[model samples]
Target: MSYRLPARPRARFSYTRWQQRFAPYLFVSPFFILFLVFALFPLLFSLYLAFHLWSPLDGLGNWKFVGFENFALALGAQDLFWQTLKNTVWIGLLAGVPQHLVALPLAFVIHQSLRRYQSTLSTILFLPYITNAVAIAIVFATLYSERLGLLNYARGAFGLDPVRWLGDPGMVPYSVAAVVFWRYLGWNVVLYLSGLQAISEDVYEAATVDGAGRWQQFWYITLPLLRPMMFYAFTLTIVGNMQLFEEPFMLLNDGGGSGGAGLTTAMHIFNTAFRDLDLGYASAMSWLLFLAIFALSMVNNLLFSRGGER
Candidate 1:
């Protein structure tokens, strides 16, 4: 009778414990759910559509399996995909190269000279980046007008003939590139400014004590230290420029202005998918563009890595 005395205590549920166990997950669940519904679903569907010939007119189940035919057509010599790709690359180089060249030095100057006004200047520089894309494009379209535009007006004031900034085939790419450059230049400057700020003042002081001149310190110290940020900014520019659409679309219209000179791969893909109603081919071309962007990004990464190692 004495041996059977003690009874075990059962576990009790606590609201606090339950909340602690699942609160973080519950908070994050909305993002994952939305991502699955919106992002992942669309991405997977686009990939599936890439292999099938279907139009919205044909509806969902009427799709016919075409395998890699779409990809083949995009890569073929007769297709406009290659030309659009060339245009895209040319415009990207025009805009992207100068962005870094200007931003790095500009940021360096601001960082060194205008520390007191840094916040105000950063805000001003960032205004364009934050501005609406459509609005920017529209304004730029007005400025790029052949005769009535401010730019041509300036040229005319200088006793120059009003050049067709957006009309000439040779000038269309440069025109589009200029807009892209103006819009993104400030963003790169802000990025470089941030990078410059992260650098230690002690390093500069040490260099100064060791008799290193400003230019020498900048060339040897600042640039090397800023490599990571440069790599980041370059990757963004490459990716953004590769997918460029709205500026060209708005400024040049869907046909990409005279001779299709401003037709970027993105605009081409849009026309293929929407205007031409060849969704399958467009999807395939999209994947191809993705591959191109990825390849360029990898090359940029490799260059940066090599520079770092050296």
Candidate 2:
């Protein structure tokens, strides 16, 4: 009896079964944990900070509950908020309108006329989108030089006077917009190209048999079918243009250069938060800008949904 065999490790499958059930969760847990600590926490903190007055200088827990004061200050007539908004919209339209305008036709051309060279052309076009923003801005800055720049040289060749690209306030926005357009043009082209490729050739063949011309096919078939992709591309453009920074910042420097024509809402927020040490004000401005972006996105959604229904 005393020599009774120790109970065999019979069917102790709990640990193995549990691990099998939860291994995926264990693997994915780190992402959610990191996201909670880094993204969700900071977002909530920023929202809280938006309603209160505090700076890093004031230390943690010293924030004063100022309610809507920060919002009021930003939206007040005296603040630079309105001007920045206007600048942002202007540059956004300048860059965004033409981006789609040019990208659509360019993609159509490549898809229809340059089938054999699609890969090469796409790679060439996509280069700018992948290029470093700072590098692009710096190179563009030199090209925009009023005196000895290539642009001015070209103007001189045309017997026209040199235009101050970054220097003149009137031209600064356009200059910045041009760079933005160039950088994003290829991205949109690629998006449209992918959309075009996904379209069934049978549809186009049927249209062709029905005597549809190139323009008619594009207008009726291509554009209509490409709506989903267009919506996606347009949404990207809207969000990206609203957050315009880096290029303008690098090209014009932190001060936004000459009359602050190139100063976007993002730049203003950065200056307020970091340079001026007004964290709460900047947070409020950010939330306001976010609201504006949301409103615009909703409008776009309504437009697309209505078109889809029609």
**Candidate 1 clash figure, as a count:** 0
For model 1, how does the per-residue alpha-carbon lDDT over 180-258 read when each residue is reduced to its tens digit? 8888899999999989989999999999999998799889999999998999999999999999998899898999999
What lDDT does candidate 2 reach at residue 174? 96
lDDT of 2 at 258: 94
Please estimate how well model 1 matches the true structure, expressed as its whole-model Cα lDDT: 0.93
- Residue pairs clashing in model 1 are none
Taken over the whole model, the C-alpha lDDT of each candidate is 0.93, 0.93
Among these predictions, the greatest TM-score belongs to: 2
Residue 235 Cα positional deviation in candidate 1, in Å, after optimal superposition: 0.5
Compute the lDDT for candidate 2.
0.93
- Residue 281, candidate 1: Cα error in Å is 1.0
Alpha carbon lDDT at 101, candidate 1: 91
Report the Cα lDDT for residue 53, model 1.
96
Instruction: Give TM per candidate.
Output: 0.93, 0.94
